[model samples]
Target: MRFGHTFGRWVLDSLLPPRCMLCGEMVDEPGRLCAACWQGLDFIAEPLCPCCGTPFAMPVPAGMLCAACLAKPPRYRRARAALVYGRGGRDLVLRFKRADRTDMAAGLAALMRQAAGPLLHEADLILPVPLHPRRLWRRRFNQSALLAQALGRQAAKPVLLDGLERLRPTPSLGGLNRGERRRALAGAIRVAPGRRALLVGRAVLLVDDVFTTGATAHACIRALLGAGAASVDVLTLTRVVRPDIV
Candidate 1:
């Protein structure tokens, strides 16, 4: 029975062979990442910034905060990120964004699950920061919603895509400092009517693909809190941290 099952599995694999999304290398697994590519992926490990959860050289102890946090703390109660947005990390995100490689969303969400782990148990709903209707029409999909749905499946929570609405299309936050980013994103997001009760007095987990300046997430958190959310936690697949610029 075991050998028969193994042979059947091999036949199925041969019919639908797995391949790495980044390198196109044939893989032995179902997902897009291969063993070598997975090993090369740089994950954010320890000694991270408490405010935005970016991996740093030195640890910022509990209750203590990083310079970024001291200068301008984000609205969310806490944030966690899986990897730094550099090298293959940036490539992965851009590929998913511009190149239309929607398959990468699953791989990225898996990475977030690993980062979030048991923290999934702490949230009542998984909310994806919505995109403006104009942008959504152009892209035909919301990356954050894809991430939230993927995470919700693993976390066993209802991924709420319409929990918040983007009222306007905020300018790209590229090359902006914390203050500028915050101002640019302000008034861009709000809790949707009727849906506000879903988060009232509940712990909400905001999901996004990347944490750059955290402008978008902060805006979303502020709106959710205003709608009576007891607390908000954030999770992103990756974070952009350029030391030379920061």
Candidate 2:
């Protein structure tokens, strides 16, 4: 079986050489970036907030939370993201979400899997931040669900695609304050009726495309906890980091 699979792959590769996902430069594997594009990615690393995983400007003591986190904590116990939503990251996300690049799910999920760090190990199940039926109908797909499914496959974890539901459709949240975002999203998310019982005592890992403000993720996490989830962590494709440029 292995030999046949290898031979098939060899034939396919010979017919169509792999190229970089970003620049289209030849590479050894599909759904991967060449050296330049890979290095261009700002992967989150150490010296970050233990709670939210926001990269610190400089080295800090262990277990130190960022100022924003310390003043008003997020609902998720911990969070991590693959890239700072800078030029490169933003381009990747836009192409994936808006340009019919669902094929990038595996590549982007691989990136998130790397940044997941210890979060994946502690999580009992993976859930995507769902879209409202209206939005789902318009968009035709939930990018977050795609990421969650791909990441679950790579991590060998069970993905509950319908674990949560968006109760209503929200307008564009741009230019809204944190408080405003919270209000807009209040009562807009809940654990799926069918999954509520199964979530009890489980540690959930919520997946999303981007983390701009904690409002959306917080609402989802709160619902998970309210449904009896023991804990909730978050993993995102990219995040809006501070100007400090960690």
Candidate 3:
């Protein structure tokens, strides 16, 4: 069996020589970034806000909350992201989400799994922030759902794709301020009918592609809690980190 597996890998590699996922440069293995691309990614580490996982510029005491988080805490108990949404990360996410690069889901999900850490272990159920049926039809797939499915498999957790529903389509949140984002997503999400039972007394891990102002996460958390979920945490592939938060 071992010999056959090794031979199979050799055949596959010979046919499709291992290359970087970001750049086409040949690498030791497939589904990996080249050293240059890997170095360009800003993976979030410790010394961040405990509530929102916003990385701080300077060293601070552990468990300290950022001013924004302290002033107005997010609905979710905690949030974590794998990468800072900057040049390299942003391009990668955009390609995965907008360019029909579903093949990138596994690689992105691996990063999320590392970032999720204890959140996955503690979550009783995993779910994605839903897209409205109209948008889903247009896109032919929910990017978040793809990430959630991949992460669920890695974590050995049950994924509930239909656990939440988007009640209505909202305008683009791209240019909206924090308050405006909150208003735009208000009442836009809810637990699916007859699906609340799955959430009752469970801790949920909400998955998404990116965390901007967190308007979407807030809405999803409200719906999950209203459905009797004991608690909810958020995990995303990337997030916008503020520079002034030092």
Residue 96, model 3: Cα distance from true site in angstroms: 0.4
In order, candidate lDDTs are 0.80, 0.88, 0.89
User: How far is each candidate from the true structure, as Cα RMSD in Å?
Assistant: 6.4, 5.0, 5.2
1 or 2, greater by TM-score: 2
| TM-scores of the models, in the order given | 0.86, 0.90, 0.91
- Candidate 2 per-residue C-alpha lDDT over 1-246 given as tens digits, one digit per residue, 9 for 90 to 100: 646865776677558977777787999877788999888888888888988999998998888888888787878899999999997898889888887656678999999998998999888999999999998887778999999999889989999999999988988998998899999999999988888988999999999999998789989998999999999999999998874432
Model 3 misses residue 187 by how many Å?
Answer: 1.1
Residue lDDT tens for model 1, 1-246 = 646865776677568767786787987665567777777777887666665666666655555666776787778877888877877777777777776665566677888988884457889899998999999888867888988998898778888899999888988778899899998888989999889878889999999888887778889989999999998999988887755212
Q: Per-residue lDDT for 1-246 in model 3, tens only? A: 646865776687669977776777888866578899999899998777888898888888877889888888778989999999997889888888887666678888998888887899999999999999999988878999999999989889999999999999989999999899999999999999999999999999999999999999999999999999999999999999887464
* Candidate 1 Cα lDDT to native: 0.80
The list of candidate 1 runs beyond 4 A from truth reads 1-15, 59-64, 70-72, 242-246
Q: Residue 88 in candidate 2 has what lDDT?
A: 80
The Cα error of candidate 2 at residue 174, in Å, is 1.5
- Global lDDT of model 3: 0.89
Clash count, predicted structure 3: 0
